[model samples]
Target: MTTPSTLPAAPGPTPAPAPAAVPAPLPRRRRRAPKAPSALLSRAGVTALLALATLYTLLPLTWLLLSSTKSRADLFGTNGFAPGREMHLAENLEQLITADGGVYLRWILNTVAYAGVGALLAAVFGVAAGYAFDKLAFPGKERLFSLVLLGVMVPGTALAIPLFLLAAEAGLVNTFWSVFLPGLVFPFGVYLARVFSASHVPDEVLEAARMDGASEFRAFRTIAFPMLAPGFVTIFLFQFTQIWNSFFLPLVMLSDQDLYPVNLGLYVWYSSALSQGHPEDYLLAVVGSLVAVAPLIAVFLMLQRFWKSGMTAGAVK
Candidate 1:
């Protein structure tokens, strides 16, 4: 009977293969621990400090704007932050342009020439010198660079007297060339260009161009120059700002009011206002100060993207 039962069991459905075991999900990586409260507080503190710094920097600019709106009498009579009884900005500007046979306009044009031309020349020379320093192998390269670093550390103001003397010796004093020539020698710009070239310009690319029979000058002009555009722009802007705001150098070099930059002209007006007791000159100075800053603001607004890109260009690659 048992044998008969065993025989009957043979027809039963075969057991399904045991389902393949699923891999237990990999242990989930432990999530990063939440930042400590102290760390969060530090970040908040840093953000607050930055905000305060920005406010401090902007405070004077705010005062300038408010002061520009006031008449000469209101400028001193009222709170520095308060608006005047009447906005004299338009009238002040009209006086600014028309005063002294439109000498202010001439000063603006002179400033453009000095800053624009000087910055352009500085960019060219700086880029070329930097490229040579970076790519070329020669004796005394490091020493020359060190000398440049020394020059950078030396304030341009400190050299103003010597530069003036040199200009005098060269018979360039009291001329546009005196102010312009000095601005063209931007050691810091060369340093910056060298730093930029070392990173942005690859040796391999230059070698490849050389292999293609492109002369070094041609390669630099067509290839390297475009790659170094950001650096060039940075150098140009720096030199432009320096030349534009330059007071002592131009003051020492230029005797002609026609050759005076806006900064120098403004200074003359401010001095005359203070010394000659002309209250109207004070209003003109304030308005002129506002006008003088506009170009710089416009320049920054226009080139801000380029400036940012240039600053961060080599940071990643």
Candidate 2:
């Protein structure tokens, strides 16, 4: 007990702990200036502008949908934005199908054939060309690709006459081949495929396939094409939509009502309404237009995810 009491002279009164260091005061941040009134006005203006743009786009479709539900009487008499007093959509559809010996159905079938077959072949060619551009080196490759880019710049409308002339020379004008063949040449699809190839596909994998004694075509079929699926879907949808909506080209090439796409057929009906004073033709055209629009919407909805992913994939490293 005594030894414990004498330890280190009682530890020199337990040396008071060093005074706690006070941290220097932090520098204060500068206060933000109040927002200017113009800043608020600018935000409000931008919001208003976007709202107007949205309204502009949706208003027409809204009118189309509402009008499609109405009979001829209601379509012209009732509120443009409001629903019909009685839905005549079924009757309109029946008229659309039965009118002119079921020509509308034939037009639909022709359009589907044109859009589907053309888009399919175009996507295939475009993917092949794009893959060649990205992976396979050849003489005049860059120059050829530049020519393709030039093709993209040339509007389809501008090319309509030239295409018609080419079709005429081949004795294909006014035939399905005339429209189908032109749609198969999608330079933009080639460009998009090249972009997707560069982004999504790796050269190492291709080299590995080649090392495994795979031919270029075999490698593409088995390895590259699968990897480029998103791009292919995107291209197909684009080409399909393009061919589906092609009016000027078909108009320039075809005079036969039997070969008319839905759009052209609807236009024929609409023109007849104006010139021949057929009231029912007007409603038929409206309903036909709505029907024609359905495929586009359906295709977009079904494939939007793939399209979005394909588009975004190219943006990444």
Candidate 3:
């Protein structure tokens, strides 16, 4: 009976455990100040550089435009940007056309033939070579491609002599074939074509074509060539411009004025002008150059869409 009445322990105040130390918030990393001034300065510098580059490219053309309108006296006397007292562009063009028994027209025709035909063949040949290189498994493929790369690195100037010799051996020197033949072999076009073929021509599509009983050439012609049309335009434009501007090769290859490209023809006339100090000759060259550049501008404007597509071909979707 005595053990049945146990009392509970009395409640007592107890000290609170010392507060756990709060970690000091890490010092906020000081945000770097914006380099607004330096950034502005860098942007300004780049903008200025590009502006200068544009000005540099356009300045000559502007001068050519202005000078072509000037009379011989005005060309030397007027401010380069200023229009002349009278427009002589018509007079200059007439003179250019009639000069030296109308040899300038002959040169223009020759240039068209060389650049136009050569570029077409070059594009096809390069694209085919590149397609074969990328798609076909053949012995000496890499080795042959290496040679093409080596050819690319070697400047046309370096090859002029060797080519001249080869043409001489073949009795093609001083003929249209001399300049036209060399322009057809475009190493850079081949390289670009390989890249384009690798990017644009899917292996799956080619395999599917094979499965459908299409021969390799038929697949290439029907399926691949259409895909590579932009690339063809690109290569054609490049080689066409190259052959159009080609001077040294033509100068070395051709002794006959009849076979001279427009560029070479101009060189001959310009040299004659310098030797004789003929203002009329100088005026003729200016007009001729202006005329010559028009075709290039037209071609580029017409084909810019294809060129842009070709350039951005390998971009991810």
Best by TM-score: 3
lDDT of 2 by residue, 37-128 (tens): 77436989889888999999999888999999998999889899999999888988888889999999999999999998889999999999
Best model number under lDDT: 2
lDDT of residue 65 for candidate 1: 90
TM-scores for all candidates: the values are 0.85, 0.85, 0.89
Q: Residue 131 deviation, candidate 2, in Å?
A: 0.6
Q: Clashing residue pairs in candidate 2, if any?
A: none
Q: Model 3 misses residue 75 by how many Å?
A: 1.5
On residues 62-176, what C-alpha lDDT tens digit does candidate 1 reach at each position? Answer: 8889998888889989999999999988887788899999999999999989988889999999999999899888999999999999999999899999998898899998888
User: In model 3, which range of ten residues has the least summed lDDT?
Assistant: 34-43
- Model 1 TM-score is 0.85
Q: Which wins on lDDT, candidate 1 or candidate 3?
A: 3
What are the lDDT scores of the predictions, listed in order? Answer: 0.89, 0.92, 0.90
Q: Can you give the lDDT of residue 154 in candidate 1?
A: 98
